[model samples]
Target: MKRILLLLSLLTIAGVSAAQEFSGNIALESLIFSEPGLDASQMDDNITLSFKPKWTGEWNDGDDAWSVEIFLRADNRDEGREHADIRELLWLHLDGDNEWRVGINTMFWGVTESQHLVDVINQVDQVEGIDGEDKLGQPMIHLKQYHDWGVLDFLVLPGFRERTFQAAQGRLRFPIVVDTSAPIYDSSDEDNHVDYAFRFSQTYGDLDLGVSLFKGTNRDPQFDLGPGIPHYVQMTQVALDLLLIADDWIWKLEIIHRDTDPSAYQALTGGFEYTFYGVYDSDINIGSLAEYSYDSRDEGQRGVFDRDLFVGARLAFNDAQSSELLAGIIYDTEKHSQSFRLEGNRRFGDSWKGTIEMQVFSNVDPSDPLAAFEKDDFLLLEIARFF
Candidate 1:
């Protein structure tokens, strides 16, 4: 992750320099813990804070095209206890339309979310992240353009399949050739250099339809593989990502199959299958979820049939007060133990403002080692400012 940040800085410098604009916020959260095992000796209260800033800049070439962006993030918790994630990307074009991006940015799009700014703020705060040696071997630059109803994007980068396979296991995979003009990826093996995706999207009334046909890199991100796995053994999520949205309904249909190897990273994204959707509101609403993830990374690996069906709700007493709650029954995913949770947050005071919240996690299986958590939980109250 440090290298990623370092690379971002280097890219900014390498490009034509320009003045930039910025804006964001900072927040501090106070908490209290009461875990049964460690509850006896617990802090009455703890503090967790977040900060974020942005970069708004652009570069142009005559009247052809230009790019602009504003990015922000926070990288830590309880000062710097948690990991941080990147968040932000707003682009523009002087002539036609541009829609589509590759690499990490694509991962963000595949998942529906609105907490990117919050994610970036967390990333800035996290000092610990994907171990250094586990970083993506290929640094890619992908883009998309449009013509009528069809779309096109080139996952352009160093060398293709032929050359890449030859250089596999060796550190010299990214070959550089000098030229009198400028250095460019020798697209000679362009065929083995597969053009991964082709998508088409349109709208009708409250319903929207989108189809993506691309060569997807494996499903479960490769970062989970750890540093020991050779880069060549990686998996790919080559399939179609279909999405449809109608009014309060959101559906994500992924048709992905995996290639065999060891560990979660080797399989395509859908190892744990899920297909169910529910909707909520701007402030309060309730929704249900049923999905499964073949999460076999930690020592607590459970077999494939871990299915969960649950309902979650959020409420706001008013503009300044609110609460959140969720409860569910999980099977195989928890055949041995049933699971549940409850949480709420509220704000109070005039001159001295404070936010209070509590969370409880429990397991139904008495024999399950995690059952003790049902009787023990954590509470928090935070007071701070936003500027």
Candidate 2:
């Protein structure tokens, strides 16, 4: 609460001194489960109300600027989902060919749609969603340089944000709840550990390539049994991502090699998407996607996508309403488990939008990591009003 107040105060002061822009949205979300939870404490339905506001101010003839975005949520069923975060609060200075950013920010660095194997800068906001796409902001100093050959990015992260988890009463959770209060760390510095990352990206002909190196505490944590306490470890990672664009086809690939305390592993995800314009002589576009994932880690230490295949389709109605739908399924070859997801959204007028999503699990093996979610199929509906 204090941090929010301070940020608001700062924004207010900046707004009074310079020309500022303000925008935001308020959303209401509802989730309904298809089956009962494993525990009696979990609810079959949940509701959440969220607000996100953004403010930006430019000074010194647009050479320097400040941006602030805040997110707050209130959940009716799960206390763990009722939280707040500073999505972005940073000051940016732009020179002729260089850029500098300091403060809390979010960075993304992957091209694969099924999984983001190389995006390790920010911690995952687990309570926000199960897809692992949401992230918590990190405090860092980022420097970027534009050269003739490529673009160079260097980041010095000073503080780490721990991953969030659901409460015991929350649905879509593990059989044994994770105790977020007592986390163990391999480094004695714990959350104060400093991290560094460097990336070089360039485009050649029809292909874009990015290579990155990171040395720091791992964002993903392993769990200790009996109490389900998270254990963070120090590690180093080298990653590469590529994207190639052809007439109507797009190819994406992401690979990573991670070196940890006791073991090392390599993982990769590669996919292709092909789009057909004016489908059926209508103003609709359809796209087909296929992706494969592989991991060299042992079964116990691997994630659900270790040896999986993903196939999906995307539909876009090029209308004034901006309607779109995406549906996909991930099939685990080793465990024979399957996960299906569908998401669709449409704009309702100019200021309102509606979205619907569904998640289903099928043929989940008992030994698989997704076994806990076998009975947790859910449907979500959301409505948002933008200002």
Candidate 3:
């Protein structure tokens, strides 16, 4: 709360002194479960109201700028889902080929569609979604240098954010409630541990490549079976991501090798998407996607995506509403389990937008990580008003 007040105060001061821009959105979301949850305490339906506000100011003829974005959500059923975050509160300075940024910020790094294997900068906001796409902001000092050969980035991260989990009464949650109050850590500094990362990215012809190195506390935590508390470990990781653009085809790959206290493992996700422009002589474009994921770990220790295949389709309607849809299914090769997902969105006039999302799980094996969610299939509908 204090941080939010400080951010608002800064924005108010900036608005009085510099050129500023403000924008935001309010969204209402409804989620319905296909079946009753395994736990009797879980609810079959849930509603959430969310607000996101952003403010930006520029001075010195755009050479120096600062921006703040805040996200807040209120959930009817789960207190864990009701949260607030400073998605971005940063100052950026640019001078020729050098750039510097400091504050809380969100960073994304990956190329594949099925999963993001090389993105480890921020902690996952698990209560937001199960897809692992939502992330919490990280406090960091970022430096970038642009050169003819490539771009180099260095990050000094000071604080760590623990991943959020659903409450015991929340739907789409694990069988055992996660006790996040007393998380264990490998480092005595715990959440105060400092982390560092460096990345170099370059484009050669049709291929764009990035390689990164990180030494820090692992973003993904393992569960202590006895207490059901999350345990963070210190580790070093090397990651690579690449994209190749070929006419109507796009190929993507993300690979990572992480070393921890007692073990080391490598994982990779690779995929390709082929697009058909103006299908059937219409304004609609269709894309076909296929991806494979692998992990070098035991079956029980691996993630749901380990040794899995994902096939999906993307549709784009070149209309005034800018409608788009994506549907995909991930099949576990060894376990014979499947997860189906569908997402679509369309703008209603200039100020309103509507979205639909669905997820279904079938034949989940007990050994798979998603076994707990086998009966948690759900459909979500959301509407947002933008200013």
Candidate 4:
């Protein structure tokens, strides 16, 4: 709370002395499940309201800038789903080809469409969803240098934010409640443990490559199921991400090697997306996606991407509304389990937008990792108005 207040104070000070830009949105969301209830503790109704606000200020003729973003949600069904977070609060300094950022910020680094296995800088806001796209703000000092060879990013993270989880009343949760508060760290400092990372990315012709090394607590924690309770086990990870573009074909790959107590393994997810441009000479564009994921671990995989195949499509309607649709299915090859997702969004008028998302799970074995969500298929609808 004190850090949040300090960040707001800085934003106020910056706004008073420089030109400021403010924009954000508020939204109403509803989630409905196909089954009556997944468990005894499941909520009957799923509805929520969210508010997102952003403020940005510029000074020194654009050489320096500061920004803040806050995300808040009020869920009527589950207290765990109702949350507030500082998504970003950072000041940036730019000098020629070098840049520096300080304060809390969010970073995303990966090229795979099905799973972002290489993105480890920020903790996952798990309550947001299982997509692994939403991330919590990470407090850090970051530097970036650009040169002919590539771009180098160095980060010094002073604190670690543990991943969030769903409460008992929340939907789409595991059968056993996760004890998020009890996280065991390899480092004694726990959340205050200072961590560091570096990444080098370059583009050579049609090929783009990135390699990163993180020597700190892992963002994704392994849960220890002892006596029917859960606890986080921290570890370290090294990752690589790459992308290749050839005309209408785009290939993406992400690989990671992790080291944790009692376990060490490597994982990879790679695929290609082919676009059929101007389909039938129409303005619409259609794209097909295929990806495969592999984990060295046989049965204790934390995610659903172990030994799975992902197939999907992207649809873009070049219309006034900027309509788009993305549909995908992740099939567990070994267990014969499958998870499907369909997401669509479009703008409504100048200041409003709407989104609809549907998720389904099928053929999940009782012993599979996704067994908890076997009956948790849900559809989500959201509409937002911009400032």
Candidate 5:
């Protein structure tokens, strides 16, 4: 993987140099724990640094282009977290409204505030954060076509990427470290399995609709403790995502029905966001978000948001600093568990910015899935300088 990434980086750098269109950034991040015993090591340093560089170029009047991004960190707390990745390394060709892309790229789908049930193309960078918002790029041949009916996307994934996991010394992980090195697959070819997907999306007036199908290994891993190791199970999934825009209110819905060997179930996440613009003529915007998530599985489920309600608020100052604040709470009705998160960020001049985030878990029952993270509350600080 290191050799492949190095080669790609060299190629991307060369291409960007030839095109003379280079841009990137330098970022510094620090994580401070509110309490100890979260990870196995309370003696490690609380502050760490990471470096990310990105470059992109285009030719033939923007019809052809290439982009690459590299992430590197200095901390060695968790072997999986303190690593490097080629977040994006793709070549794109455009013809009218149709497009073709080849290489590793990241894609997102779904229209919900709390969870993304229909977004399954890219693997999650689990070690990055617990929100599951960060993703690792996947190698694929992607095609997008536009028509009168809507837009259709066809993806041919030649290789599968294993999901990252927290090591034993990681803070936001279970007591027993999941061994992601030797993952088992249902297919004989293992990581070489060819996964494919199809999606069709359309927008009519203020309503947007999307339907998708995926057939291959599941992104979420299922534990196999019999062999005293962790592995993943293969599954097929079909999903639907919908969004409705009405004035200052937006409604979102995501439903997924999947089948696996041991069990087959359906999951749903429905929500809405209401925003008030220019509140009191102060150039401040406030938005309220409410969502409900459900899973067909009973107790001892693998996920934390099985029967949970999520309520959140977002505040945007819309000033020269570009300041923003977001606060949210997730309440599990079934297990009587709750989690809260606070996030804020602001820009300082044209080339520098900073961010602060905090997460807290409360009222967690022993039987709840989030019980492991009860003591993992933490605060994160990040600053970046753009070029």
Candidate 6:
């Protein structure tokens, strides 16, 4: 709370010398996708809202230079499993182009491996910079992290926090026992659970990089292939994205790297590493999706590395209809096994979006015990809204 107050005070001081501005944004959607290997439910839509007021100023107190921005975002929607979570975005700039920023930036990292590199580069390149606003897209938080030239920054993350949780209720992925003899976690305790998160990130330029070392938890954290499992994931992420704006088209190139452990309770947690490469056209909304990802983990072999291919698109049918398509193939290196996936996202009206996903795994390797439960198929569906 003190930090919030201090931020408000700075905003007040900046406003006293000049003017105050108020603005907001709203976007909501609803729809339904295919549920993974379960009874399909009826389609549904939801609502969410965001409001913000902002104040900005240039204070030149002798050698003391300052700038500040503060904002608040609250949302309520039926599609959300947590119901609601109110978050804040704070940005402050000092001297010329150096600044500070804090908040949840979804455009930072996405659910797919192809989009992962964008987050990493954003972290490593941030060096302290971002063009940000409230959930409404209004200029709510601005730390002047950048000026005409570049940015200056620092990172502060002292110790780490650790927690061990269980998949008590939901079913997002397989359950992970302390030591399991199977490739997939135990299916009985299937639920997407978030155990703990030890994360840190930094920025350089058009590049952002973030690293999170933690256990998995929450229904939201589960995998779509199987019931979400409560696994210990030692995750590391790096992303680099470049956006080029031209007269008629925009060109974007991004790369991401990730290494994760599928099981947490095991004595030695060694798992798979997935990498992504994404390219999008400047003028198209349903930009193409192409990615390369791989994973390697076996019975006695705690870890190995495999590669996969991804292809799809973020297609928009019209002003009121929008959808994203993600399709790819995963390659099992050991026995040359292979898997394929099809994921779809659709938006209804302006406030609701539905996601439908499906996966098929194929392998008859008798030597791999984990391959036993590799079902030839699976599916998932979800509805999400933004305000």
The clash numbers for all candidates, in the given order, read: 29, 0, 0, 0, 0, 57
Model 3 RMSD in angstroms: 2.0
- In order of appearance, the predictions have TM-scores of 0.50, 0.96, 0.96, 0.94, 0.94, 0.42
Candidate 3 pairs with clashing backbones: none
lDDT of 6 by residue, 53-117 (tens): 34433345423333233333222322212111122233333454444443322123322443232
Tens-digit per-residue lDDT, 1-387, candidate 1: 476567557645643354354444455665455633333332334455544434455556532322323132332322223323333333433444664332333122232221111010011111211111111223235566766655554444332221111111111011211111221222343223433434455545543444443342222212123332212222333334444554545554333333324543211112121223232434445544443433333433322222323333333333554444444333434444544444454444432345555555444455433443344345655554432
Each candidate: what lDDT?
Answer: 0.35, 0.90, 0.90, 0.86, 0.84, 0.35
Give the per-residue lDDT digits (tens) of candidate 4, residues 87-177: 8889999999999999999989989988888888898888998888988999999999999999999999999898877888988777777
Could you give candidate 5's per-residue lDDT for residues 1-387 as a string of tens digits?
Answer: 477468757866675676545666667777776677555564233566666677787899989998887666655566657767778888999999899999999889999978888999998888877777888889999999999999999999888888887666777777667777778887787888899999999999999999999988888877754442556677889999999999999999999998875788899999999999999989999999999999997567547879999999999999999999999999998788999999999999998989999999999988887888888788889998877
Compose the digit string of candidate 3's lDDT tens values, residues 1-387. Answer: 456567656765775465378789999999999999998889899889998878888888999999888777778679778788888889999999999999999989888988988889999988988877889989999999999999999999998999988888887777888888889999999999999999999999999999999999999888853556889999999999999999999999999999975589999999999999999999999999999999998767787789999999999998999999999999999989999999999999999999999999999998888889988999999999998
**Candidate 6 global TM-score:** 0.42
Could you tell me which 10 consecutive residues in candidate 5 have the lowest summed lDDT?
37-46
Error of 1 at 162 (Å): 27
